[model samples]
Target chain A: MAVGIKDLAREAGLSVATVSKALNEYADVSEETRQRVREIARLLNYQPNVTARGLQSRRTNMVGLVIPTMEPHLSDDPYFLDLLAGIADEAAEHEFALLLTRCAPGPKERTCYQKIVRGRRVDGLIVVRTRSQDQRVAYLLEEGFPFVTFGRTDQGLDFPFVDVDGTQGVYDATRYLIGLGHRRIGFIAAPEGLMFGFHRQEGFRKAMEEAGLAMEPGLLARGDLTLQSGDVAMGQLLDRDPPPTAVVACNDLMALGAMRAARKRGLWVGRDLAVVGFDDTHVAAHSRPSLTTVSQPIYDIGILLCRMLLQTLQGKPLEVRQILLRPALVIRESSGGTIS
Target chain B: MAVGIKDLAREAGLSVATVSKALNEYADVSEETRQRVREIARLLNYQPNVTARGLQSRRTNMVGLVIPTMEPHLSDDPYFLDLLAGIADEAAEHEFALLLTRCAPGPKERTCYQKIVRGRRVDGLIVVRTRSQDQRVAYLLEEGFPFVTFGRTDQGLDFPFVDVDGTQGVYDATRYLIGLGHRRIGFIAAPEGLMFGFHRQEGFRKAMEEAGLAMEPGLLARGDLTLQSGDVAMGQLLDRDPPPTAVVACNDLMALGAMRAARKRGLWVGRDLAVVGFDDTHVAAHSRPSLTTVSQPIYDIGILLCRMLLQTLQGKPLEVRQILLRPALVIRESSGGTIS
Candidate 1:
């Protein structure tokens, strides 16, 4: 029942195009006519047809956030949720809505990207949970579709990506445990297929090699970076003959699991087992023996990723392709302190 | 480069229309032509233009989920996350993408709805957290928009919805506490604005009334439904002249908070403050003392809501407008004794 330009023009005895131009603040419309058109449109509650406007301008002002299907680990991972809050908050601020699509990581994902691109459903995509030599990245590039990555890829082919300093985050966490006079340091690695997971393992090995410590293949247990998997990995680690006293999990959930494993064995967390986790999520602080971990500003990354995608969709040339946020180690009782 | 229909048709020595008809499985195309088109399409990696097909048929194959934006109590509600996971999982199965939008509950929410509707971004909407006299529902009805609600509203408009049986959940939890020989009962309420929160309180009242127990206003405390808020509510309840032996939290997080409060006061939970919670989320099991709570099939609700919307989009009569999924109570040590 809202007023259309035709109705407004007929009422005012003006042309429909003139009515539209006047209300839309075109210079061709005189001040008197513009005011008259506005008054009429206001009375009629004439909401503009965004679809028609979008068709003409070729801009939807909508950015799509395509998170790889919440898989075995990512779905349970509160990390993505925290990050989503940040991205959504920023998108709301910029008057942009995130068309969220949770697609499976492999070949099945192409359907969503195809629909999004051809239907003009979204202006750009925010790619997340990057895999080694990710097909999505390559697909976007080949299709000339605008997108930004949440993590860096192995090829390092320049694309707009906002990622954590994964290798450095591991380096700092591992180096801290090493500096605490611990030589028999065991590492909990992330799943093999993940890009961040690979980077973290590399960071851990690089630190050990730099310190002239032999990387013990036996000491490394690959966890899916889930709390449950962490528990399983910890059980494996603790069962080793007079197991390594200290362990560094690539993520906080794994660290918590390790803590649980130690407790089950009737061992004090800080005294018998020194454990550290990466990505100091909320659970890290509330943990019984306050987890010693690496803190990454995840919320900030989400906001930056959204801003970066907007820039790309707006056809702005990004001077920098990869922006890595540094993570700092937070020392707590989990790294062998008075368990107060 | 991936091939188009024109390329496929040219390579196969067929007309573009014949190739299209063959790929579309139209009866007009000969079997030989269809086989030839398929081979060329597969060999050349000619991804189908789903959007173009959808446009011809006027179907976007996308649904939107609009949840209440950051409410103080339920803003970070873990329950919503579980429900979303279910919806996302089901939507993926049916070849649908979800466009997620968040808006604070107010008149400003209309803008978000308008964007989705007029922009033709989504085929239908999945609404969670409906309030009494919801403006969104009214708007949808006025415009003849297809939608499904996750929670029922006070308006009693029989719109398509999938909801956990809140009354049954609360009644069962309350009856379980009563069976433990605890006459005095306290209900920790979430923000009253939530329809489910109000229903939870109603169930608690019904259980008490059925037992012919006189209601005490002193026993009722409002919790924002977070663990911290639950702790605060428990403290307030304890401060009352005569403390209730058993407390029933609207959700598990609040129960966890109450548990922590009991621990801080040097009171054994199972011994002193018998507690029960609702919506048995993953955090419910992970909590210390493993809370006894109501198990609402959140994933099932998500799937049903999506399926309901799918049916509506496919021109199916929404024969089932309101769906109430049964909720079962999970008895754990937090509720005091093992109830058989």
Candidate 2:
């Protein structure tokens, strides 16, 4: 009972083919004819059934998100929520639905992706938390599938991605501590495999070198991005002959843990030892002392990533594929700032 | 190319119709004959194309979750993350995907659901955070669509659902505080419209009445289930004449906020003013003074809800339709307990 192209064609005094071309923005249709056909279509309230159109176009108008559930508890964090919210925002605007799958990082997960892609379950895919020499990227690149990632891989294959400037964020964080008269600064680094860990470590090293500070072997401790690990790492740092006056954790959870370590040792966080963190998550702002941290625009990154994926699916030019966003430093009470 | 039923029939020395019935678990097929056909099929490595099967059966191995974007920032909370994790776990086990859509509560959102239901976008849906007289529930019930909810509605329709006993949880919270030698107990309640709010408030009142404790008119304050709202409500409670020695916030975030209020008033959380919260989220354990909370196995609820929906879709008996799980009270440091 819905208005069809024939109705628009009859009203516009044109053939069904011409009306279709006009409505679909075909170059064969003249602007005046397109306008007339569009006006008639609007007058008749012609709403296209997207599913039927999708079947004809060989596109499902659905985006696939396969989260690696190797660490099932990781979903308990706000990171995924922020990313999903951004993608969901853009998806609602485009009238596309997100098809989410959670799978382990194994051959079974690979098969799941293959099924989704080969079966035409989704129009495109959005991959997140990319690792070095990622197999998913290699497979998607080889299959020529439409896909985008939140982070880049070291495999050197060019693809669509949006990443935050972690190196600059850490550099700014370290420099901020230096300006606070902290000569011996302790660093809490992330485990070695992640790309952000490498970039952030480099930033810290460069900042220290520029300030003519000698790196103490006991000053830098590696954490597995957990509060417990951060607490242990901070304890090791404090056990040294002359402990550092300030500490920088790669993530906010770790920074919060570091503060707990300081408190356990009966030292004021901002006064005796300044502590700063990365990611500036909600907990950072609400913590008792209010954490000083580097903040990535995670929601914005998610929005941009979805937009980039949609553009790629639409066969947009490759120039808009790569995007890099700056991470800002938010100074709060934990860094000895009273202006929280 | 995979082996078809015809090949299995030929190998098993049975008719194609018999082979088909055996493969599909038809009750008419003999157990011995079915075993013979299954053995031959397994030997040949026959793999069914799920999408093709779905087209024939009209059952897409997909579930729907349309989160109301009226509170978009709500997704940022751990509550959503935990719920999604549970659902994702079950979906993965069943080889099903989740189709997520974030839309506002309005006509447009209703149309979105209708399209998904009528257009066969998903086989079933999972609705959460049930409000009074929810339209989604009404629409789903009216259409006879397969669905399960995380919370129950007041409409009293018999359907599949899995909800924690929030009333008992709050009642237990109030009783626990009273057991800790607190006579004057203050309450930080959730806003009136939410079904849980009503249940929890009733629980608190019932427990208070059972204990012969007089609840003062000035002791009750309402919060919107956020940290800021909890902080505000706690402040109001503290301003009362002879402020209560103990407080109960409806959620963990608000409970944490209540703790902040106590600290602001120069009172020790465990020693001076005991605070309790609901929903033992990740931050509740990691907070400065670990929160005492009512713990609902949210992940388990998700799994059960999905199982109920799947069973309904499969035309299972209604005996396993509704489920209500108990919420346990976890006493931690914030309630003056060292046993976290």
Candidate 3:
């Protein structure tokens, strides 16, 4: 038979209540008695029933993370995996297990949130890919659930989140290309529904306007953050009457795709046409000729998100609720150019 | 206040015990009463307390998956992510949430397992990367825990598992290289501790013996299943007195790495040195010259593992206790050769 609190209490010559208190670290138990009870519990290899303890003290010691992706193959996007690694690392360090789930990208996702949070499956949740009017965020807020997000939304709510400065990253990349004597620059942008997508496009527009460059409609193409989409978008730009001398893709996978398109058109990447990508994924570093891109501290953001959630869970006051990290432009062979 | 069983019973004009029986679909409850109870529960937005229900039935409706990797950043391995996607898809489909943990790869891992399985955190577990004489399999077997593995171990114990035929994968890759009239072949192997490592090595040796080709010691190099490791291992092979014209890496990442190494030496892949890899990941298809690899139905195996574990969880009879799926060779430009 599995060892229970009753067995530990019997062995330690203490009441079952006393044994439970000692195990849960209740302040009423004396130190000496607590130590004795713990020793006996360890000797018997007793596993404290988390469920029973949760009933008494409303802490499940679990965190929830729901990925809102219709893509069954989330592996294609390295960004999600990196964020997961960061979250997993911090969750482990803080002694919290991560409960993961995926919701189909549509309206019925609120039911998923209610099932886990209202069902008391997890104490807190981690939300990612925040839309402009994220119902998940609103629901969590109204329900007074402890949660954190990887991106900030335009929902006009105060919440804890860790977001990378995508605007500055794209703006800097465009400025770098402008400084390299590239007046005609093309942008392969992310879908407009995403908050980051809007920020990045705005950054590109601001940079082009500041540099006194003409922002032609043909120079801008839309991509859904996939390699194939990048390829098609880049092709659209190249087919213009005056193709862009330099190109900037929203993410590394798309950036690599742009390079392939340039290569197929017999243009040398560094000399004839320059390319830049965001997110600086591992593949970007290993790509032939290498990709110059903006690097987001993805793993660090994950750790920070988890830490912030833990502080809220522990009822500790946070010094800062909103944490924004800067992304840096990594120079490599793909954007090679001498002084203008 | 959250709706409870008592509230449901009162609203349905039934006793608490009768409501519970109807909700659980007990034989004592009539079909009309069961439907009425369910409709009333839904109307009230009543979420069954999974924890309290689990206390009575000892079923959490959650499965566990722990990745045993020393590398804190598991994003580098696309294979792991694919497996996760597969597991997540099936878990969501079955109305079961997944509990994920990362055991710091060492002796401390056993404590992590005990905490989750023994503490009743999950109903079953899914094990991957089976090692020779795996203590995990042994422990789960001894405890009679409902678990399934992605790979088999050398423990000589009968258990439910969903495994890809790695031996056949490598054997066919080697045979395909041999068919190209390339006798000087190099092999990049995974770490020796993994059961798949042994099986893949045996396949290489058997294929070479059948082809009457010399298995030179200098032509064999070991890698830890990373792109950089593949590059270093491939470099070692190329440093041989007469470098092999054809190379086979245990995985696609390493194969790409080996191709990088060959390219650095000014050798054109598919022309000078043919390369083949296993586990045809997304990158393999997008690589510059494209990679030839053995494709394991990773997503399918993930779904299969969850199905098997669910069967064990529900106490249902399994049609086939042990499932071994075939791995097919996907030919691409990387292994382009006729009479090399």
Candidate 4:
């Protein structure tokens, strides 16, 4: 059996009520008595019940992360893994534990949030994959709960967030393709509702307009950010009256899928067609012919988000409530570019 | 302000004590009163404090997973990510939250375990990366805590665990290499203390002894399961008087590292120096000269471990407490083998 406060009281020759007050560091308790009680408790190896103490202090020293597993292939993407590693490492450094809750994207997601928030299971939360008009962000704001997001939501609420400049990243990739003398370029965009989708699409359009290239409706295809979706989208684009000489995908997986589609159609990636991708995941560097991608420091973003959330929890005024990191375009064989 | 039990009591026209009794479903409360209190709570959207409830019930409904971040490059490996996804998905199915705590291996690791276990912060735990005589495992066993390990310990404890047959996996790879007309085979083993290290090394030795092949001590090198370590180990092996033509790495990252080392020496991986890796991770299939590896369903093992732990927590007898999964060898170009 584990030692308890009652045992500490008996060992210290004090009343149970007196020992409790001393252990809890109540102002009514004498400082010398409190110290003596704590010493005896430590020697007895008494572990205070965390839940009971949390009731009194109203602090759990834990942060919650709710992952929406609506996409079946969510785990296959290493982005979340990198983000989780960063958060976990930083949380450990601060002596805080991270509580993870997984739920589907609809009503269940709200219930998952409520359980953690209403129950006060965690002191703060770290939100990811924020969409335009994200209900999760709105709800947290309404409740005045502590949270920091990894992406921006268009709910017009002032909240702390860490995000990559997706428009800049996609714009750079598009300009790089145009610089390679590829006028007819196709785009594989992410599905609707994601904020990055809006930013990245704007970047592509800005780049194309700057080059005075006519927008082709047939050249734009939306993908669910999966390899299969990218392959299907690329195939549709290839079937158009005049196929594009180059393509840019919103993510590395889709870009690899596009490469696979090109290969099936008897086209060599670097020679016959050029491809670019986002999120320079591990597979991007190792894939055959290698993928050129926009690199976002996802792991570091997680660390930063956790730090911000911790600050918010402590009621510290944030020096900067929002951080938008610049994304760099990494040139590789897939982009048909010489590494300068 | 969030609705509390006091609010529910006021709205329901009952005393706080009676409202609490009804909400708690105590036998002393009348059935009608209980129904009335619940209806009022639902109407007011009252969420009970989870910590207080946990203290009363002695159940947190949360499972802890303590990841050892001693290895700096842990996030770079997707194995943990896959495992976490499986566990998180399964945990969500059971309405249990996963609490992640990261700590460097050694005294700090034991402290992490103690905080969660002694504090009763979780209902159960899922231990990973078991060592030959893991102190965590021993401590958990001594405390009679509910836990299921991803790997086995050699402490002779009758505990629940799910492990891949590392010996069989290595034996199969070694035998396959021997069958390929390669007499000199190099082994890149994992560092000492890991339980899998012992089993895998045994498998390599058993296979060599069965084939009447002389084992060269200089051909065997240990790596810390990182890409850089594998590169250094492979470089050392290649400098030997008669370096092995075929190499098998304990993991895909190390195998890729070995391939890089071999390429630096002007040797084609498939044509000149054959390589085999374990844990057919995402990078293994996309890598140039695509890796031939031993495939263990790491994600599925995580799911199974979680299920077993849930059963243990429920005090249900596990149908099969100790599960040893077989690892299959996947043939690819890296092993100089045609896929059959």
The most accurate candidate by DockQ is 4
Task: Report clash pairs, candidate 1.
Answer: none
Model 3: per-residue Cα lDDT over A169-239, one tens digit each: 99999999998888889999997778787778888999999988889999999998888889899999999
lDDT of 3 at A252: 90
Per-residue lDDT tens digits for candidate 2, residues A1-340, read 4456677778888998999899898999999999988888767767554445555676777888888745566533467777887887787788788888887776786777777766677888999877777788888887788999987778789988988888899999999988887888889998765677777878899999999998797999988788888999999999987888899998888888899898899988888889999988877877767899999888777778788888778878667778887899999988883211
The Cα RMSD of model 2 versus the native structure comes to: 6.9
Worst 10 residues of 4 chain B by lDDT: B68-77
Chain B TM-score against the true chain B, each candidate: 0.92, 0.82, 0.94, 0.93
Q: Return whichever of 2 and 4 wins on lDDT.
A: 4
The fnat scores of all predictions, in order, read 0.17, 0.32, 0.55, 0.65
lDDT of 4 by residue, A11-99 (tens): 88999899999977789888999999998977776777788888888989899998865653354567888888788878878878899
Give stretches of model 2 more than 4 Å off.
Answer: A1-53, A261-268, A337-340, B1-53, B262-268, B337-340
Per-residue lDDT of A111 in model 1:
62
- lDDT (10s digit) by residue, model 4, range B151-239: 88888888999999999998999899989888888899998888887888888899999999988999998888888888899998899
TM-score of each: 0.88, 0.82, 0.93, 0.94
Rank the candidate models, highest lDDT first: 3, 4, 2, 1
| Docking category of candidate 4 | medium
Cα deviation of A331 in candidate 1 (Å)? 4.6
Q: Cα deviation of A289 in candidate 4 (Å)?
A: 1.9
lDDT of each: 0.78, 0.81, 0.87, 0.86
